[model samples]
Target chain A: GAGVSQTPSNKVTEKGKYVELRCDPISGHTALYWYRQSLGQGPEFLIYFQGTGAADDSGLPNDRFFAVRPEGSVSTLKIQRTERGDSAVYLCASSLELAGGGNTQYFGPGTRLTVL
Target chain B: AQSVSQHNHHVILSEAASLELGCNYSYGGTVNLFWYVQYPGQHLQLLLKYFSGDPLVKGIKGFEAEFIKSKFSFNLRKPSVQWSDTAEYFCAVSGYSGAGSYQLTFGKGTKLSVIP
Candidate 1:
């Protein structure tokens, strides 16, 4: 793909329900990241992966949030017992590598998750 | 913990007016800085980034940012603003680790309303 892509552009789920958001990174991108953005706020880091391993997951809010990049290409973010506070836009981004040589991250359209 | 701060939460300007958005970060080690923009109903896009060398970096749409290492600041500026520049601007900083784990920390964001 030319750019990162996410599934379920909009999701409205009841509180306490389980939900999963998916991300498909750009082709040949070796690094993938997940972020969360609330209304009127900027995006916050969630998780980062290099290849198939999660290089950094410290940004996860709590145990209720988990993300996995099994094949280093497609990733899934799972939330257990979602709460109203979880309502926000989930963004996904990918870069060629994280070597710091000006690896520009291309972002997806984002999945707007609304917990009702 | 490293954090990014944006001075203004909201700003209003007329077309052709000069624009400036303040960004500051707190990090002791080497880091990369970036600016991202989000138009209404659109995804986040890269405005500019600073990795090393030049303190002043130019970006698309006549936007530029200056990275001041001593002050830990990377401020975005535009000589002339246009109505199309009305959007949310975010300042981000990514910590550099040897393991290639790059996680970006973003400010709360500043909304710019450019009146035509």
Candidate 2:
């Protein structure tokens, strides 16, 4: 039983560069979510996908942040022109069905992105 | 403008001590509550959750949470804690928007340190 997993456990990039973080959800999970965690803070919602379409993207801070889950099982969070403030741990989670009150989300060991 | 609050920022206790972590959320309508634990280098794991039915919900590893609708709180408790329970605890809430999509809003986690 493989849990949700993220690629590049740690990534260091320049302030003005672009970065793409990938996530592989647990087998059979139909819903995926992206979140960001800053130092001393809890995770903040970024985006959510149900199947192949994004059900909610309101949590995304700005247009510079975009995510896609074309295949419904894997997702990628792309950041354009990264900033120092964007340095944080990017987390991914997935559930067996569309996220509601009862479904439990399984998280991945987040990918820590450091902008220098 | 939904928000979750964790009253304690850090808690240190000895093994076998009773543990309780406070969580309160502010939202206008029906909500789903969850408690997640993150060990030193591991991913976030679901400790417990409360949806509709019983106010008292039990989760894995002897953890439990009680949801009080009137108080807008979902507090996590464990009668006796072990050193292994030391980790960061997060409280999250998701409002039922009726659109079939719910995004989690998490609190500024509480770091628990259990000494053996």
| Model 2 superposed RMSD (Cα) | 1.4
Give me the runs in candidate 1 sitting further than 4 Å from their true place.
Answer: B97-100
Scored against the native two-chain complex, candidate 2 gets a DockQ of 0.77
Q: Positional deviation of B85 in candidate 2, in angstroms?
A: 0.7
Per-residue CA lDDT of candidate 1, range A18-70, in tens? 99999999999998999999987888888889899988887899999999988
Candidate 2 chain B lDDT trough over 10 residues, lowest sum: B94-103
lDDT string for model 1 (B15-108, tens) is 9999999999998788889999999988899999999888999999999999988898999999999999999999998877544567788999
Q: Report the CA-based lDDT of candidate 1 relative to the real structure.
A: 0.91
DockQ of each: 0.70, 0.77
**TM-score, chain A, per candidate?**
0.96, 0.97
Chain A of model 2 scored by TM-score: 0.97
- The worst-scoring run of ten residues by lDDT in candidate 1 chain B lies at B95-104
